[model samples]
Target chain A: MSYITGPDVVKYACSCGLLKPISHLYFCRYCFQLRCSFCVCHEVDSNFCGKCSENIPSSEARVKKNRCGNCYVCPSCQQELSTRIASKGPVNPEDSKSTPKKMYYLSCQFCRWSSRDVGIPDQSTVTGGWPERENVHSNRLQELVDMYKAIVLAQKQQKDKDKKKQRGKFLSYTDRTGVTAAALRKRIGLPAEFTHPILKNKPKEPEPASAKTEVDEVPEQLLTEPINLMEITTVEQRLLQPEAQPVTVDKLFPVHKQLSIKRSLRCRHCEHNVSKPEYNPSSVKFKIQLFAYYHIPEIRIVTVEPLRAGKQCELIVKFTNPTQHQTTIAFLKLNMDEEDASLDSEVAEVIQDLDQTLSLQEKQQMSLTSLPLSTSQPSSLISVPSRQPSLTIEPRKISQEVNCDIEVPTSSFILPPRDDAAEYDDSGDTHNIQDDPKLVKWRKSNKAFIKLNVTPMSDLALNSEVVCGFIMQHIYTNTVASKEPQKYNHKVKVFLRLGQLVGSE
Target chain B: MSRNNIKILPGALVCEESKLRGDITIGSGTIVHPSATIIAEAGPIIIGECCLIEEQVKIIHRLPFDQQNKENTTPVLIIGSHNVFEVDCTVESPKIGNNNVFESKCYVGNKVTVSNGCIIGAGCRVTEEQILKENIIIFGSKCQMREGLDRPGLQTLQMETLSKMIPNYHHIKKPNKKV
Candidate 1:
């Protein structure tokens, strides 16, 4: 007997006629049925690396080859054997004067065929020269051609399937308009008899008093509008077969127009080809026009904390725009390891409305607090966070300011101890250097301020002090191309450490 | 086994004391070294020219099952030219083609077709129904071609190393022997 805990429980027999726990069953969303592992047959389709294969429960064996990486076979007898580099020198090389020759072993399990009997050279024995083979076949020409053709066909099929699935959904005007008659009339023209009858009967229905009262009793909103029957209906032209009679042309050719009296002229002095030219000579001077000015933002690292395995740290990021013009920042993006590590493609977006109307500079502070810990294990002293914790917008105007703060948990950073400290201490101390009181107190009071000057080719500076590390990212905008902002993003990660004394005074 | 009377055609290799019983047709540009035996019992063994037979290679016509009944045995081993047979290689009723290189100690089963320009690397065992394509390089022999070499996701070199080794042997004629 099994006991059910938590929530309502439903028990049913599997297709294999076995009773299993609910967690062991799978719910098929398409068929709305329960499926167990035993109910369906699983086939291995492909083989991957053993480490990845074990982690991937649904992986199949690689169809191309079944053998593991380390196994090899004897070419002569088709038997599995161990192939290794034979020792060359004597057991104690100092005692023996002769050089040892390396050899390879090929032992057959069935016929007991050994390579030693044949005097074959080992792999290590031949370094530069081409090793010799003993057996050659004469009729293997057609097999190679068939293999190449099959591989090309499989790739083409996969590309077609991917294109079919990549079509995106977007709203269009045709989807909203339900013009059924208009669409049919555009495809096929209207009949002539139906149009003629409507024109002849148009004036006969409006003259009766009873019909006028019925029209007036109808809703005022519906009766007030004049309905155009021609606009509501559509007529399409139909191509009919021509009468079976051949028509003859009266004139074969038409008279051509007389040529005008024109003469081509060439410059006699310069030998240049000349044509009719319009002479418009005004005193003209070229002038350079500048549409908009671009400002480059500055980035600086404020504070960094190398979070120990059990410890937690917070990262504070600040962005300031010291520009004079009001700017609208569009979007901010962060990248880690040359790849977009954001959980979503559109991770951070900021729309800054700076006050450019008045000369007063507006500064907005955004605190990105409580960033989640990265899932990767820490291996070094500086735990490079898999993803950047902060992102800001592209500043629109020059000298407009926006500030953003990112509070990263202390558990994300893990700093490894220095390995070369043994000679300096002389006592072979193995204590964690992060436990020092100075380092702890320094991390508590770590703060950084970044000042941004959004000038033409402006530079930003960021400064911070903390046990962990800090990274600052700056994005600048270009306004030359059709009002679309081109972002030039930059980032820097810095690790902080306390200065140590080299020698005793 | 007269050492002075050993007759080797230009670019043709014959293993030491490899007693050829029946009529054998050896093509031009073939190599057969000493210490390798090619015995043709019932049917004639025809070895095409430009074929490389390495040291200690054995090509016997007699099947293992017919050892007791040697008088009623019928098995023919025909090898084509321009093929590289590595050391200690064995072929039994194998029909090989041009530009194929067999690495060290390759075991060829009965009636296997080794396509042209195929590289059978060191220690490969090819069984029946195993058809290797031209310019196909098999790494670390003992790869049985029981199923036609149509397995998906198998990566192979563009031009086989064997084809590059034996240049001017097929299609182009040149008097050179350097591998």
Candidate 2:
């Protein structure tokens, strides 16, 4: 349970400069940059019912107002309602020919709310055929909509006519020939001017509605009787049906379950998918998942000594390499400006060129997915797909304050690649590598516990939390963009909250 | 510690591996699984018919610190009919009503009184001193309570299957009294 609700002690700084745990950040392989939800573009991949896991086509979803047709939720509790069969007794118990049809009703398991509570009759078929309520003012609302449309069309027509009249900088043939059209019309005995025929088909305005003098007053029966508050619906219950906002419980109706969508996250800078789920709704696997945890070394605090202001404290943290290739980790000053200028430009340019040729195979696989849309929709009504301009968010400054200083280790450590079989084997360590005994506390397969000396600033107040940060630079191997893997140093800032400062020793 | 004074009614299935202490009565048709601990430390515990006490469930009747010195009163823990104490759940409630389900890994403290049709959901810990209203369903990690319209369905089929399956695998403690 602490995996989800626990306090995040270890955080990695994203390329966008927000501090988040490794799982929440996405790794964009194309740009080799960390992207969080704030920096990524989320697009709906498919629409599906969460309860039934049935994928609904985008066009069908639009027609149904983005609601699942077969699934429903309880009006009282807003939980998925299951269809339960009610087997009624046969009309004639002894008669051989008599049979009873099974009736089905929607019921919520959590609150045990049945459709019969709201007077909805059971259906003979399993699929829902629940009665729908029609809005009383729909016709009047449609007429008002048409009136507004006609008014806007008439205004547009007048503006077009005015624009045509303004465009006569040069004279016409009739004027250049020393005879104006009006004077020539009298000579030829023609009509004064032919009005633009297209302008005659003008939109007509509807009659304006007048307000009624009388308003709805409270009924006489309400004043005489005490209201039972239990029988009335609460504000949350009423708001569930915004169209009706039923005040009484008896008027409650089963609501169609809203359709859920699976979204794919794309890096806004490069327009490449960072995380994409499989097309099947039931499949829990992802087609493209570039999580930072898969590519970067994970760090967790193991133990720390008592913290005092102006004193050096020993802090131990465990580092684990998750990738299949061995990587060397080095500690550097937590300054991003110096590192950004000296690193990554040449390697990034090399990768970007290789990505063009390497992405040809994946581009075809991604382009073949076309959701079949029914052709009955008119060509004009179907919205044409237009290219959306890619958006890039400016990187923000890191917000965490480091109140403690860390002594950067001069020597770097090498972490072996992850081995699945080593977890089950009971054999002792076989790999021989020289290590700095003062820095390395312990070592195992793909994991090591390292020690560091941290000193809290002298001016910090007693009982104030002390946080320390450092830069962890690791060699990242990129094998996807080329046949031969190219290695580049990837630097990430890490922060650790080293408890609170106590009294001075 | 007091001696074991267990009275198993006819047709009650009590496995030999279960740990039952002090004065206790197992009602007819009740199935006590192996390793279920029923420690009646304060007073007698009377369990009703068709109760399913599964493996690793601890039904303890522990008296409070002040009540241990008093001689006049010994609070009896009474569990009602058709109640299900699922696996690894600890129930020390003073009173439990009929058709209640204590789901797996939940802890019901001694001060809480579980009323009829109450469901203490899986992994929930209810330690407060309050009487749960009828048909109250407490679920989720936060123990959010809602009033269910009706009681949860009984585990009749599960009990029937267990009755037929358990006797073949474990030794049964036969009922001393006849129906």
Give the candidate number with the greatest DockQ.
Answer: 2
Give residue A426's error in model 2 in angstroms: 3.4
**Candidate 2 to truth, TM:** 0.79
For model 1, what is the alpha-carbon lDDT of residue B24? Answer: 57
Off by over 4 Å in 1: A1-505, B1-16, B62-76, B129-137, B141-179
Top of the candidates by lDDT: 2
Off by over 4 Å in 2: A1-6, A94-100, A133-239, A246-252, A336-389, B62-75, B105-115, B121-151
Candidate 1 lDDT tens digits, A122-194:
4553221223322132123234344445555555666676566567466444447865544655657764233
Model 2 per-residue lDDT at A296: 87
Can you tell me the CAPRI class of model 1? incorrect
Q: Interface RMSD (C-alpha) of each candidate? A: 25.5, 4.0
Relative to the true structure, candidate 1 reaches a TM of 0.21
What digit string (tens of lDDT, one per residue) describes model 2 on residues A26-77?
8876666677888888999999999889999999999898999989887766
lDDT of 1: 0.36
TM-score of chain A of each: 0.18, 0.77
